[model samples]
Target chain A: MAVNDAGAKQVATYWEGMVNSGLADTKAYGTTDFYNGLGSGKYVTYLAAGWGPGYLASVAKTTSGKWRAAPLPQWTAGGNVQGDWGGSSFAVTDQAKNPEVATKVAMDIYGAKNTDAWKIGIDEAYLFPTATPVLESDAFLKKKYDFFGGQTVNDIFVPAYKTISPFSWSPFNSYNFNQLTTGINGAIEKKTSWTAALDTAQANISQYATQQGFKVQ
Target chain B: MTQVETRSATAPAVAGPAPRFKRGREAATGWLFVLPFVILLVAFLLLPMAYAFKLSLYRSTLIEGEHFALFENYTQAFKDPLVRQGVVRVVLFGLVQTPVMIGIALLAALLIDHATSRFSRFFRLAAFVPYAVPVVIGTLMWGFLYSQDTGPLSSILHVDFLSSNVVLASLGNVVTWQWAGYNMIVLYAALQGLPREVYESARIDGAGPSQIAWRIKTPMISSAIILATLFTILGTLQFFTEPLILQPLNPGSITQHYTPNVYAFNQAFSFQQYNYSAAISFLLGAVVFVGSYIFLFATRKRSAL
Candidate 1:
């Protein structure tokens, strides 16, 4: 991480605003409280990836038709550079007993030519259209989701997806995540200044990377 | 089981005479009865521990190929601030929580033991009910109660229980709530088994109810209290579940390495450092062992003071 203290603080302030505003509750996750809170209108917004709305529809029963798809709120004015939190992938491993059949099934599941497969994958399973055919399909582009009050969410999402910038990943992704969380958490708790927390995280991650024999720039 | 019993019965009949052979036959039957348990003990406990010890002796690194690095991981763990800080924090937590829990348990047990009303039965059951609830579930419940907004306790008390300043104590509360009931049941059972005549004699000696409880009853159950203390100490040293469960709510307070067991878990699963994780786990085991040993040694005389 570059350890941009001001940027980190801005991010912290944004989250703190929600928590302070009583819109977001930092309640423990994986509990009934977590699930029921959002459904009960305790949480106004759920931030997640392209596949997130599908999951929201399953969990959000009362607010089904009240929802609308919108672009993520920008951290900075016109800040279109984006990141994602979730995606799905498929593979036919060498361990498969019938590798040829497995490959065919896996490829056909979202293959460009398989309209029926795309229908099930896109309309029913709520998968993001990855194939070009599915992306250009009239049904996909114009379809109105009842959950979002019959809005064509593809109008918002298809363009939003293209806004994502190239993100370089670290081999030590988990370490980076832990350290970043610690820094942000410390900033949120007001235990340390954002700069100090970020500096400490930067130092720690650098030292760890060095220990793992990565050249620290 | 019947086949083994039949075999044992037939053994003495075929081979040996009555007197000295009785001992051998009885020993064989005892071994037969314990064979399954011994096998499980070796397979689950001893073997896994042995493998972990082996793992602790080696570090597999990206640059350096896997090789014997005897005590290197141990040395690193000893100096690791996270490990030291976590140990000190937990030890302090145990110092506070263990006694508070045991004191509460003993008080509850004594009150129930000598209660005059029918409500005492209900109180005893109520106290024991938390023990029936799983620790994770109990922690989750407390997490809700501790939430700053939704929880009535927080709104009423005007405190954020999961705040960094107080989260450690908050975790202690969860563990105490979960285990106090179990300790209460143990102490209560011990209290029930005490001879009634001792209390009668104490009363005749002009001892007040409080005096009788503190002087006579407490001393009588010292062994069970010590046993419970040992268990609580061990549990406290390896504290993980509550902190782990509540981490997401207060991420900074309950950092990945907030406790030794949680640290080991993060190191092994998150960082993929199995060797270092194993080393830390064993070091924590040593700490727990030494902690209990010191307690037992200090109190071994059991009133010689």
Candidate 2:
């Protein structure tokens, strides 16, 4: 809920400054040229998800072993701030003919019940399940990817995922994200400062939150 | 809703005061022919429009709950700086982009019509190939060409096409590129329909190809040009696709409320403001309709003129 009040100002300022100083690529990544740019060394690092290896491996075959993973530097040195992406949930639709059976299947597929489902998920797609037991398991920890020179990269991700600062997710995430992007982009264009952008986002999101019938300070 | 019922509903209107018995068969047959289209139109466009209109009159929120808000959403939409900015942008875009596109199409059509070379055939197809490419794909291609790191032509063109200041013109350029060829084909078809005797008469008066093209062919194709202009204006008024496609590439330049259509989508999907979204969409529809109407009415003239 906090925008300008949070360290968002710091994060926004840092990246926005990087872009304005020409220290960052203005071009968006995840494009066709992105992979080629990687091979050409246009990028030194890619801020990718924990499950990025499967996708990265297919596109970045030429630079397979050269890749390395590292934690994002904290704004506050030794700060525990961390986040994740691509979190998903399963649901049984109300219209499902066998809702009860569908529910059980959904629960068991990646739920706490069995290792087989998760084992297949990891082997196939590099899915990072939220199961603490799975995270602590030796097989999960030992699994190595040739892309990162067989580094047990989840060792980096698991701790980071575990200590991800507790926060209530805004129901209006899409609006918040859109405003954030707009602000960040404006800052990148040097039309506004990063802190100014955060301030704008703060006002915009707060107003929008109030409109959605939520009390905001 | 069915054939018999639809025919019955249509019967009184098509019936005449003096000639009811004689023309009833002919009118009934005509109505029957149009029945399928009427059914489809009612099923799709009108019903959805009515529902959206109903939604626009109400407000629904987590705290406020659902209630009749009358014209509150419409009033808000009108006053919304986002909506106003988007409208002003599109109108400006329409004023510039539409004319340029139509002129290019007209010129291209005239030249292709005049040329008697086999290469003209190739040129015609080449011009039309952009039209064949979908808008989404064409914008993507342009996005690549405008990319600083990877675009092949960006440096050579000497324009930072994706920069916020230049992005509207860049979008205009893309739209003009997309539609010019299609409009050219339409105008060319209209040009082809003109009698060859008109050209013969003009040439007999010592009018050269340029004179014939300007004095003879151009005026003759004004109807087609107007039609093309109308379509382009409507297209521009509802401009969404290129901006939507290009937004991610240049998020700094393109905001969520970059265009009215895009704003409606953001409201409905992002903010869960369905009522506001409906209001925005309906207001945009009014703009498109009223804008096109004014153009037509302002330009309305006797066919002979």
Candidate 3:
């Protein structure tokens, strides 16, 4: 995504088009209240995390048994691709009285070992485990999501994860996100060319990154 | 030495600056009385301000830890268009909202001060009710009211108050509603302090209520008005809580950079760019100081005229 061959201007132009054509509304998902509208079938499509199915079923019960999982679309049709929305990880602090035990406990919840059990335990909590072995396990594969029209969503997600290009998370991720979102909103509101908006955002983010002691390319 | 000490003690129980021990006890008592407030002010206000100033001079990051950046962060603030835009936005807000709010407050005060004014108590309480509402709750309430999908106001009036085109004005309206009464009270108190004989003399001279309000009463309370305006300007520059609460519900229009305070907050807390955040805050404080000076100067010139 960072090295998009179409160039940054084109990416912005495409986003502007999406906004203009009503393909996407940047304002829609600014908050979790969007789920209320989504549950009532106000939107046809949305980017979802692993727990999205369970969430949709519980919150947007009206759409239950109608939803299904599918591979995220590639930038170019049939191009090898994957993208992630959001995920979380766990860490142990130095202040922990028993670092070894703390590490073990954190791993038991988040690690690949016994992922099937972890997944089942957090079913109501609505989490998708990131364990490869458990994802491919028979128990995990056999379980059905009636809300997602009885599809094995994990199978699709597990394969999708393999195709995703490895990317590094920057220490300045929040600033970057702010710049992009703010720029996009301003552009949308003013009905200006997205290229200008994106260019401004890029310049600001790069400058800020440099000012914050990050190595800027 | 013992004989000299005994003679000195015998000669002066009430002499020699009340004895060193007595002086020390008195000083200790005074310090003890002021200790709590001094500690609180230093801990909560003075120390944090000093820390922020210190942080403003450095650039801290995960890769480099903390490094001396000197005025580089402040320089970046100067160059940043978002910071510039945010300042301009708030200045405009102050320009519009301050006068409008003061005007409404002044009018309400004058009306309430009039002998013929009806429902004075009711009007006074009604005007103040919004001011009593907590800013976050008030903003959130207004957010719901401004909602295009569910808010009754949008459906009834057929207008989206949260739309980018009118959102600033909508915020001005909210601010005016919240502050007009408070300022009204200030002006009202000033008005009450005026000599009754002045109004009587004005009445004798055939000056009508409106004429007296405009010609006599207003000029008399000019100082209070200026004070209120200064407060309003200061308040507007530091605008944060209201817009922040409304931002989540009114996305695309309300960004993290919507206000200078918000921008600084996002930089420090969200981006972990504490140095840059500190720089932004100091710069904002500088702006406020300059703005207040300009305002005071203008008011002084007007009074001279």
Arranged by DockQ with the best first, the candidates are 2, 1, 3
Clashing pairs in 2: none
B144-187: candidate 2 lDDT, tens digit per residue? 88876678877688777888889999899899999999999999
State residue B179's C-alpha deviation in candidate 3, in Å: 1.4
Q: How good is the docking of model 3, by CAPRI class? A: acceptable
Stretches of candidate 3 above 4 Å error? A1-4, A7-14, A30-36, A75-80, A94-97, A108-120, A132-134, A137-140, A149-152, A199-201, A208-217, B1-33, B115-118, B297-305
Task: Name the DockQ score for candidate 3.
Answer: 0.42
Top TM-score: which candidate number? Answer: 2
- The best candidate by lDDT is 2
Each prediction's Cα lDDT score? 0.83, 0.84, 0.80
Candidate 1 off by > 4 Å: A1-48, A64-67, A72-80, A94-98, A165-168, B1-7, B10-29, B63-65, B303-305
lDDT of 3: 0.80
Model 2 chain A: which ten-residue window has the lowest total lDDT? Answer: A26-35
Candidate 1 vs candidate 3: which has greater DockQ?
Answer: 1
Q: TM-score of the second chain in each model?
A: 0.94, 0.90, 0.88
Q: Residue-wise lDDT of candidate 3 within B1-305, one digit each (tens)?
A: 47545644654565457577666655665676799999999999999999999999997777678888799999989999989999999989998898899999999999998854568978888888998999888878887777776677877899878778888998888888788999999899989999989989999999998999999999998888889888999999999888888887766787788999999998888887788999999999999999998888878954422
- As for model 2, its CA RMSD to the true structure in angstroms is 3.9
Q: What lDDT tens digits, residue by residue, belong to model 1 across residues B203-227? A: 9999999999999999999888988
